[model samples]
Target: MGSLAPDSMVRRVYRCMCGINPGLEAPTASAKTGAFAASGVSREQLVIFLADTLRGTAEERAPLIMAMSQCGTEAAAAVTCEQVAEFLRDLISTVIQIVVHRGRLQGWQPERMGDGSLGVKLLAEQMCSELKPSDQGFCDVSSLEDFIFRVSQISLYLEMLVAEGLNVSLSGRPTPTLLPPCRETPWKELRCLLDLPTIMFLAPQLPDRYSAPWRLVFSTQLHGESFTRMVAGLSKRGPTLLLLKDTKGHVFGGFASHAWEVKPQFQGDSRCFLFSVLPRLRVYTATGYNQHFMYLNQNQQTMPNGLGMGGQHSYFGLWLDNDFGRGHSRARPKCTTYGSPQLSGDEDFTLDSMEVWAVGKPPEPEEGEEGEGKRSILDVDPEVQAMMEMAGKTLHSQGLREPEEEQEQ
Candidate 1:
């Protein structure tokens, strides 16, 4: 070629760099990576390019974060892990100063401070590949120091930002709207941005909806007595069904076969009750993160129906009075027969005893409800009961039998 045109030269270089025929469409990143490695664009060059692109501008950074958080592709993770680390290290320092100086010094509530701090913490964790115990310790030290120093520098600039509500509040205020009334912030919007899936997986009962549920059953071994105790404890709280299988190992494998009707009480005050059972529970309420349930009893008093109803306070009080010996008691009978007596000493009883606890003596057994009556699985419409019995038997035959073999028999 005597003198290649500018366009021809560019095309040739692109084709050579990507190992694609000039006439063919562009190769994918995988193909390009393989080709470039052969032609001498080292892995380091690709990483550097990715890092530069991630740091380009707000327009650029938003797309990169969205891609890294949402896309389930290996390439996205590889690119994100490499780039987010450096970005996070820088972001952490800035966040620390903002939270410590602007929030603490200005008399912001701990919840508000925590919200800002958690955002920084989450960002830092996301940037790192694995957050181990050691990394957590390091983060604690760094974050504490950052908080303290920032608190010392509460200035006019910080006050303006607070007035404008451009910070995250611990009480689950959305980002960029720190101290605004809860109703004004975009709590649901930020949750959507976080891109946490609607489900999660853990052997016991799935990972409480934060981690996506893995459909496969996981086996955990338990001692016969311990397993029985666990089942009994769970049954007292709700209807529990379990399976114990011999996996041929030293450990006797166990799985939850079926749980009877533990419905999520999404209405009224019951939402808080459901969240109390999990290690970590995050709900996207209309205002922001529903932090009310996290430390309800510790930080604030329990609202009438056991919810932090915020401002919608109801005056009427209802108490469950269980007194078998005393005449004319107002207590409602505990629904289940299992361990109703044991609940009298539960911790939650102290704050909202009216809902779940008995105020006085146990309820007297009515004439018809005297014996150890068993609710027949048969009583549940024939189709449903048959299906459940079939499932229970199938599980039992598969080596996962209930401790009391009579149920299966």
Candidate 2:
């Protein structure tokens, strides 16, 4: 970049990570409209900034931090923790700005991370908390390197999501430069209880199916406050996330990795998980202790009705009774399948709202979608189906076995 005297291309390309102050500052150029003041960043400084933000190793990035904290001073042997926090804040702000502008939703509408939700500042604090500081409250350089190493995880996701963003990490790093060729999420507008930061946090946790924007399939606000309506909306949709807000102001739910079925038996598989959003952010995935991952049964006199995830019949990690507007999250030690504590503010929580989002591309709708044939045991329990897929075994018996009478549940 330095060899070219007229770094005009860099100037044009570098604007607002959201698209602002148009360039990396140049020494001779008196433009206040670049990334920095006309005191100007030299080629070395630009290289350092790019290195620290993207592919550079932790050791390589540490000097840039020291330079930043000391503010061009070479006298200080090290920086104070307070200065470290300030430096982290500046970098975090710039990172988020770039991510919000050029990353995930580039051609799609970009949204600033929510202040109320988990975001850059909170992430910075969490990183700082991990540092081992000296009596002077000064973090050692090694500690800073460790912190940078941790930040690299976020960088990986950023690289995977943003067009020009990249990293040297990952056992087999993906080439994120290639644009996802698929059409943008089938939906036009996004409306839901989740904030942008919350969505960003959860998106990467999804298995391999990256690039599939979450599409809202059901919401109590959009549809009606009816459990039957939820069932109808979510029944055949592929992997989905169920979100609920309790009257006590807690938000929680679970991820079901396949179509939900109304059944007398436990369904779904290990990809299923229960999550809490508000009050705290946590996801409890399968412990492999139980195959009872997801259960959604309704209108059964003998068996418990309504939707439940994790735990046994009566005690569920998260449950929404078909009775509607009433639910509970119970765990003694923790929920068996997800290993989660009670999610609602109370053991049993009142329903404030409910929403369901289909996670990947919606499957092409099939003809004769309803009452097409007799129901099989595989239809009643999704775990068996999941197990079969994992074992790489064909369901040859599915076609051979005579279908049983659909159990009235």
Candidate 3:
């Protein structure tokens, strides 16, 4: 019964409505009850609005979704697919804007998350695919109502995006942690492949230990395009998320539950999953069909040399060949390991961009370990190192430091 938030938040909500109808006016009254009465919005409507947006069931949210799709127009008996797509587009844009403005960004560099239009389109198609469409290609009330009774991620997405985006607290139950903190990462530029909504979708699915701050160990933009360099970044880093963008702009990747090791055998647990973000937003988890969870092997003349997750050796659900920029996703009907479809636009995809983030807090320094010692400036960038060496610049620091021990592969 008590829905009175701070005055700033009250105004923010009011502005949201006003954005839809520029002619709407703020009520002269200041109190919640008084304002609702004066503004010509009923008390029951406000209660239902809070219920739907805050914690209502899918059935409770269906009506509001319809109304938002109508956009203040007269009651519609049915809404077209385009209407739902537009509604989703607005919701997604609002979530991104909230992340950019209200920021739990900490120190991670914020940049444009690329065009989100295709993601919205794919999301709409996925949602509508469940409905029994009307003769006129519209979603009637019965369609939406019946679909709501079943489990759906739509409600979850709405809640997480709004709650995390607005930075709202759910009384004493809310966790202070949102995205894992980005403190003390060695990388100067901590920009990444995850849009705020994409992170909101993927983060909660991870294990609890990953709630600690994340580290940016590899990025194709900063690190040279060498599979060896990528492997170097992957080694010793506990539990990592790898995101890649293909030439067609489809973005997808997989989670590694344990630190990566270059062995011929597959490694990782069922907690590992695959996710697609750019052209669609969906996660495909393990099916327990087989133990082919993860595979990574390099410098092998006998075995396939690259990184892979799910399915089988050459026919992987997700694969990145050691050739660096070229790879294939060979899931036909579905990937047996995670039940995921081919994620890339094509089976043979060209890598446009890639990044890796190590989850959990960095290990505490060993006794007398003194300085954690910075990595070489060119450790990730071999081409840059060669260019600097060719320019006749002396790397006096390399000689002065203690020779580093080689890590066990």
| Candidate 3 clashes between residue pairs 3 or more apart in a chain or in different chains | none
lDDT of 1 by residue, 77-131 (tens): 1233333344343334343444445452222233321244344444344325242
lDDT of 2: 0.64
Q: Give the per-residue lDDT of model 2 (tens digit) for 326-354.
A: 88899998998889999999998889888
List candidate 2 segments past 4 Å from native: 1-42, 62-96, 99-139, 143-152, 156-191, 367-409
Q: Which number leads on lDDT?
A: 3
Q: Which candidate wins on TM-score?
A: 3
How many Å off is the CA of 352 in candidate 3? 2.5
1-409 per-residue lDDT for model 3 (tens digits):
0122323333334332322222222111112322322465455444444546667766656655655565433445667877766666555555444444556565555453443445445555555556676888988656766665552555654565446544555675553334556655544454456655566456777885326776778888788799999999988777888999999988999988888889999999999999887677788999999989889999889999999999998899999999999998888899999999999989999999898888755666656664365466676578988898999988877678777777669
How big is the positional error of residue 381 in model 1, measured in Å on the Cα after superposition? 79
